[model samples]
Target: MRTAAVIGTGLIGTSVALALTRRGVTVYLDDADTTAAATAEAMGAGSMAAPESPVELAVLAVPPAHIGSVLARVQGRGLAHAYTDVASVKARPHHEIQSAGADPAGYIGGHPLAGGERSGPLAASADLFEGRLWVLTPSAHTERLVLNRALELVSLCSGVPVIMDTVAHDRAVALTSHAPHLIATIMAARLENAADESVRVSGQGLRDVIRIAAGDPSLWRDILDANADAVADVLDTYAADLGGAVTALRALGSADETRRKQAGADLDDLLRRGNRGMHAWCGNRARRPPVFCRCP
Candidate 1:
């Protein structure tokens, strides 16, 4: 791509601009916050000036709720030949775009499966999306040229392309990203009133569980709201599992031997289920066992 506009100068947007600029694409950076745009420009992400005319593509790096309105407004002024977004949610923004009467053919849904807990222009990095999966959701009306432009953008950012339908994409991210963030936040919230002695001796497991809890709550709120139903569905299973674990733990400490014995069995089952999950993917394991270890 010769030219493109990145409409948000925050982490993902600026990172995209940096990546594109590194690859020799003329990138125009814009943000509602002038300081953010200037910061991105200073960091060598891209130029803050508006494009002379409609460029090759416009990447709307705005919040999920604002994508449609922003897209409609930009399209009104002929912002680019094609467009996509980096919002966490998909269906809502696509619906909003249609509602706002933006041309559907020139747009596609995009979400790069990469980020950090930190945000804004200061946290931007050119390699943030490198080697990560960037999902593209193209509708029946999406033009091949528009899809090609988006794929080129992903290639420029060193991301692998994965095509999915919009609804499936929303549900998948809700399970993997949205629900997990909420779980991490809820877990981390336990430390707010924790004793210094308790927190000071924390282990890697505790740190890992709450790592993503540091994300900006306001931005997460918008993402959760956009994909509320799907996230709720995933959280329901977590709630059920949590309840089971609580029940088993309480029973394990009961006075009755029979109850204690049954509780031990129940807890064993719970731990084994998690063990299976862990066995499925223990990051970067060099060799694989023929089968999962069944012994407890």
Candidate 2:
């Protein structure tokens, strides 16, 4: 906990380094792109110089696909006593480590449920993870010291720790983060070919829905590839809902009054269900009945 090395100087890595530095932990920063590490160092996140010896912990903030390789490389060099990662997917990375014949006792899986469309050291902020849920996935063979080091890192970053199994962590993110990110990108893609007049009239609702679509496509492709099954499960349900909405939209012009009425009812039900679901993140106030209308 006294000293740490951040293996990637991108947004999450730099943010973590900055937070740790602010907390008085000696942080040594590194990245494949030396300029990135230098940028973080210039921002006062940490020193770019290699540590004289092994640090207390090492945090891998690389892409999911590179996590295992980077971990093995660092561990082989005795870079740090314990290690963790901030990759979005957990299950695949754990598998990769096992396949690489890396020691699991010194490693723990982690994902900080925070970040924005912006990336790189320039976009990093010490408070990026504040009040966010940072998940940790520990295997049966994972050492208590490694897990404790990860928890300490999370604590220093002002994150709320939620322990979960690797598979559960993957599935949860598919529902909460990955699926939604894809959904946003899909929505924003529509505007690429949209009529100028149509796009010109867009409002806050459009911006809000498509905000995350600005994320790097290559990075998202890696995340989606690693957790394809879990993400597909969530998207399958969304596809069904989309099909039903399309049917309802076509029926709105039906010749039969009954058909139109049924379609209206279906659309209303979908809207109400969405309102109810929003309560999960929006808190108890969202659960209360509308003051102006008692209807569900």
lDDT of candidate 2 over 172-272, digit per residue (tens): 88998999999999899999999999999989889989999999888999999999999999999999999999999999999999999999999999998
Task: Give the Å error, residue 65, model 1.
Answer: 0.4
Candidate 1 regions with alpha-carbon error over 4 angstroms = 281-296
TM-score to native of every candidate shown: 0.94, 0.94
Model 1 — TM-score against the truth?
0.94
TM-score between model 2 and native: 0.94
Task: Evaluate candidate 1 by giving its C-alpha RMSD to the native, one decimal.
Answer: 3.2
Model 1 CA lDDT for position 55: 94
- Best model per TM-score: 2
Estimate candidate 2's alpha-carbon lDDT, on a 0 to 1 scale: 0.92
For 1-296, candidate 1 gives per-residue lDDT tens digits of 89999998999999999999999999999999999999999999989888898899999999999998899999999989999999888999989999998889989999998886989999999999988889999999999999999999999999989999999999999988999999999989999999999999989879988999999989999999999999999999999999988988999889999999998998899888888777665432334544544433
RMSD of 2: 3.0
